[model samples]
Target: MVERCKDAGITILPSAGPVAEMFNGKKIASSTRARDLKEGQYPAAVYVPRADTVERFLAPQSTSATAPSRAPHAILI
Candidate 1:
């Protein structure tokens, strides 16, 4: 996503977070994280894009939405 944005001349900035060290790569299109599954923990990733570059995506209202924290294999960057 970052690459696509940058390729299109968008300025992308990595947002400050606890995992600053992982944010080292300029080609990093998303941030990865460890998550728990039914049997164990494993790594997963969340995609991040420059806020100014992406088009608006309307999502369904998550009335039955589980909390983001419950995702065993995906976490926010």
Candidate 2:
């Protein structure tokens, strides 16, 4: 995955297996098709698709940031 991303610049690839995020022992997100994103020199980060996330556990915040390649992203509270 890393090698492929390095060759293509920033890229997203499927994870090897199920991935989940937990907070205070409660699952907030999970996915079998989670994506592994590699950008620049940063460490790879896993992103679970919105459809698979537990929306109830998230609260929108007023903060947001824009990137050159993507839309403005809101901060989750």
Candidate with top lDDT is 2
TM-score, structure 1 vs. true: 0.21
Instruction: Report every candidate's CA lDDT.
Output: 0.31, 0.75
Worst 10 residues of 1 by lDDT: 31-40
Off by over 4 Å in 2: 1-8, 75-77
Assess candidate 2 and give its TM-score to the true structure.
Answer: 0.76
Each candidate's root-mean-square deviation in Å? Answer: 15.6, 3.4
The reply for model 1, stretches above 4 Å from the true place, is: 1-40, 49-53, 67-77
Clashing pairs in 1: none
| Global Cα lDDT for candidate 1 | 0.31
lDDT for residue 25 in candidate 1, whole number 0-100: 42
Per-residue lDDT tens digits of candidate 1, residues 6-77? 322333333434231233343323233311122124332323433422123323343443544332342223
Give me the displacement of residue 69 in model 1, in angstroms.
Answer: 2.4
* Residue-by-residue lDDT tens digits, candidate 2, 9-50: 777888889998898898988899898887889898787888
